[model samples]
Target: MITRETAGELLARIPVSVPDQPEGESPTAVKASPFTGAERRVMGILTVPKWQQGMDQGVLPRAYQDILDVVRDAPGPVRAKQIAPRIGLPAETSKIEGVRSKLKRLVERGWLDEGTPGLFTPSHAWTANSAKSP
Candidate 1:
């Protein structure tokens, strides 16, 4: 009888068909199989790392890094509404709220500081630590 591991291996080896490509695309182009072993492992890994002194900002996912960069460059503490447009997001209420949520996450992770309600700035620990590096 096939065990669960054997069944999973069989399923992962199956090639999935690609949908029609856009115009100018070669029909003979090879498509990668969906849910390959390596891809599955990567997808399961956590994207964020908790802030620690000497830990580079590169550890963050791109979206989180962009938010941190914008806050760090600002003249002073900034609001999510002001940050959204700078980060390529529309300055609408929904988008601002989404940015606000990410900002809050950064605060919780110790990457940023909230000196006043709805205002954010880079954490002193992060700035001081990063500045000490080359």
Candidate 2:
């Protein structure tokens, strides 16, 4: 219920104390690169999709390529489900289904050639011979 003149006098009575900071240490000084170890860990978590996409080339999943190298090197067609475990996926019902979904997409994208229904081989066009072809 204080009047404006009284309020101003009361506010003027309060004093603000700010400690004197040393002038030598700059608040905006250039520190070390923020990309050092701990920050890299944070960025690594953020960039996983980009990293995975680079590994996948947008067609195969990261999980597939881990096993694809083995499958593609095999003499004959390799079944999609068979590659799941070697790529670290569980062979159990639900997880296998997820792996199968990605494998089917890889097959459809021409990144893999489905030799027999579920059996796959890498497309020769994606191989070393790609340079030789038109």
- Worst 10-residue stretch by lDDT in candidate 1? 35-44
In model 2, the clashing pairs are: none
Top model by lDDT, which number? Answer: 1
Per-model TM-score versus the true fold: 0.67, 0.47
Tens-digit per-residue lDDT, 15-133, candidate 2: 74434545675544535533323222221232212221113333334565665576667888877567777777778878777766766666654556777787777765555443454
TM-score of 2: 0.47
| Candidates in order: C-alpha RMSD to true structure | 11.4, 17.1
Candidate 2: worst-modelled 10 consecutive residues by lDDT: 46-55
